[model samples]
Target: MGTQERLDPQAGVGTRVREPWVTVVWNDPVNLMSYVTRVFQEYFGLARHEAEARMREVHEKGRSVLSSGSREQMEIHVQAMHGYGLWATLERSDG
Candidate 1:
């Protein structure tokens, strides 16, 4: 067998369990654009322009990844979004 065909026992050794997550904000007619922008700014501490940008992305694209991190962090973000009365959900990131 060629060297490339050999299995490396240490290939995945000691690798951290990275649990990627996605924060999805669904389209809801009830929330106002300004309110959404405020929520993004308040909850995530995003700058005014950045917050509005994400809000616009969500409004235009039907959804946006407000933030991404570990599962625990995502859960926190999801709950925070809920606290702001915005439609939000978390899912495993494909990456």
Candidate 2:
């Protein structure tokens, strides 16, 4: 089925469908790989293997998309990651 578009009165932008946003965590010198994996498991409830994989991705690739959803939700995820001492940011999902 086709997606529906709506006018956002607050932004005053033209009618458009809501786009997904993503929370990205960047590799940093401070947090260890184990810590990153644990954070992913604790905060995002990812399985151990999945969390480790994502942690490895950040370690090897510099960053990883940890979660995707509404902009507000992604913002929350980014904020929470910051609270955990992990560098994080949110952006519009490319796909």
Best-performing candidate as measured by TM-score = 2
lDDT of 1 at 78: 91
lDDT (0-100) at residue 53 of candidate 2? 97
Best by lDDT: 2
Per-residue CA lDDT of candidate 1, range 1-95, in tens?
A: 00113334679444444466878987799999999999889888999999999999989999989878777788888998888899999998877
lDDT of 2 by residue, 1-95 (tens): 12347778998776756557889999999999999999999999999999999999999999999888778788899999999999999988777
lDDT of 2 at 4: 44
